[model samples]
Target: MHVTDACGRGGATPPSRWDPAEPDPVAGLLATARRRLGMDLCWFSRLIGGAQVIEACDGDAAAFGVHPGSTVHHPGPHRSHALAERPLPVVGRIRPEAVTSGTATEATGTAATGVEATGGPLAGRPEVGSYIGVPVTLADGRPYGMLCCLSRDADVAMPARKTRSLALLAEVLSASISDRRSGGEYREAAWWRIWRLIDSGGPTMVFQPVFDLPSLDCVGAEALARFPPGSGGAERWFADAAAVGLGPALELSAIRSALRAFTCLPPEFGLGVNASPATILSGRLADAIADIPADRLVVEVTEGDRVEDYPSVRCALGVLRREGVRIAVDDVGAGYASLHHLVQLQPDFIKMDQCLTRRIDADPARRALAAALVHFAQETGSLVLAEGVETARELGVLIGTGVHQAQGHYLAPPGPLPLPASANRTRPPDTA
Candidate 1:
């Protein structure tokens, strides 16, 4: 029996913040209600998989032999009212007179803490006599569970106002649960879609040619991924895959698809594939590129995010390098993490971020940075490749800045290999 909040996902509550030690919003509400109503305990129990499990609680749970995750038996009638689909009257055994004078229903013979045959407020703990519970319902009018408060004393007066407040609290909990469940469902759907895509051999691969600025000759092509139409951009698809823990598999699939182009591309032209630190560290990337000619393969390590462990990534790349594959640090000058990566990875190529090249002809700041990166690359025995060059002016600026190579819409939009003649400046005449 998994104890979750009013929502169906497996957790006592949605995290209140980054810190797990902090009390969650559901727990805070339970505490406030418990103190205001003067109850010995207040807890939210979610009916998950047909078991009544405590998800969040406030007050001395141990005293009543219950805690979060404790599965308890509920009287059939009371439970029906608590989880009713409509706004029925609140159910309780608040006072001696209000107590349902009957032998408490027998408990289901399930293995659970604090569960017993006596269906009292605290189930096994017969000492709890004052109990008030309101149904928590989802937006779809389905019963989620109950918001309940109880006390050890039978004659405790649960005022009308307090009962109303409890109902309101339940309503708030219901809304939160509904919203969370909806988000969870959306993510699950997205995950399944990406999973199926990967299962079907990953996103379509397209190669955008990267050219040497001076010669304007086809040097290599960067492999870009293309998901199905209306599936959003390539970045979004990869993000969705990453969120669902399938990032590495999807990326490797893309790499494998890109490798297929090696059979079509001229031996002189190299192929650049994008990879994150995570995929590189997976230890499969080296194997993926092993069949291709080593010198004609470049792995562009994307710097959209920071790498957690540089030493491990360096070691991983080293393996690929030893086998003749080159490494390029991508999106340089776009962020501090990229700069940090440049220092740590010491890659064979430094690909300038598009932002720095977008309008370098007009922005002196951009030119200065581009020049500085080129100089840095020169000093470090690395080549600087300007990415995303979209105009003649930007291309001229990058060329004048001594960028070794460049790629973007200006160079060529990604398409099938064997570069389009319009984009191909000078292919080796001898190469077939």
Candidate 2:
């Protein structure tokens, strides 16, 4: 056996080690175990390719001749615990003869019978007088590492209760490590998926036409994104991208893809594209629509999280508004955030959420709310666009409530670009 202290001799650096300055769950648990066991040193050693690698430690590491990132070749408390088919007895007051070349105490009445010292707990560590440790296993029941406590005084007690406490702590630490590893692996996978999507030129764009409620003329189309097969729903894909810190990148990619609509849209009709508040503040949206005539674009702002700095948002939007790009406050009736956005943005359009428009003809409350929003939009110089007008009754109710525009499956579902011809109307529906 060979004992190598990496901190002093520059051996292989341990892949993972505890840093006292950082707040890590395993580090906290190791310190708690050492204090509870009343030991001078407590450490976790991961068995990597038959070598015990000191991954974490608490208390006096220098005195024990072992520090985090050190490696002990073989034959130590950790190795024995990991290999044992059953739990081994906690060795307290280890006899000198069993651990080192030192002579036995006169009181023990035994001669020196030192074991072959290779690279283990006792190699150049004759002062390690008491030892207690337990194997840490993964979810699959395979031994992953060992949590060990050591004391310099030979008379240090290893009570049954203390041994039990150490074992319980090892179990808790094992679960935490497993959970952290799982989360890390998931994030890694999500990162790669998003990378591939962006590299492939983003999501496919589909057009959902927004029609004038009375004339039924095709005024514009809202571009919606359709992700690759098996990538899950569009909303979830964007959400996962956000979780991996690629929210703005993914949104920008989608915007770029949706801009492809210009080739198919009629010259007279405009295009609407969705963007989150974060993306708007990034200062990239203006660049995306720079080449396209600004008057032909409508940026409908969608938000899952509230914006903390409204002044910054307004400043960013103000820059675009001056350049001919119109803004729409999306999902206005879904939550208070949309209402807040309307107050702050004073957008060109207010899109009532589908929930408020789904069955307004049958629900008097929804109808009343729609009327109130129309009045509000009128006061603010904003046009009310009621989304999800699936029936003639819904369309009639929306027009009667003074909604200027509408879109839903009833008019035409989202499909490949090339806007459908405007639906003809002999006369405007009677609002009376």
In model 1, the runs with Cα more than 4 Å from the true position are 1-24, 48-51, 68-84, 87-91, 94-126, 154-156, 420-432
Model 2 — which ten-residue stretch has the worst lDDT? 105-114
TM-score of 2: 0.80
Best by lDDT: 2
List, residue by residue over 198-284, the lDDT tens digit for candidate 1: 667778988898888777777888999998898799889888767655677778889888899988987788889999888899898
lDDT of each: 0.74, 0.75
lDDT of 2 by residue, 1-432 (tens): 222221122112211222234357877898999898888888887868656578889988876566777764434443454566332433445565655552222111121111222344445554666667666787777777778777776644456787789989989988987776676667667766776677677788899998987888898899999987876999898888776657777788888888877877788888999888988998989888877878989999996579899999999999999899999999988998898998998899999999999889899999999999999988988899988867777888888989999998778788987777764343344343
Model 2, residue 211: C-alpha shift (Å): 0.9
Q: Each prediction's TM-score against the native?
A: 0.83, 0.80
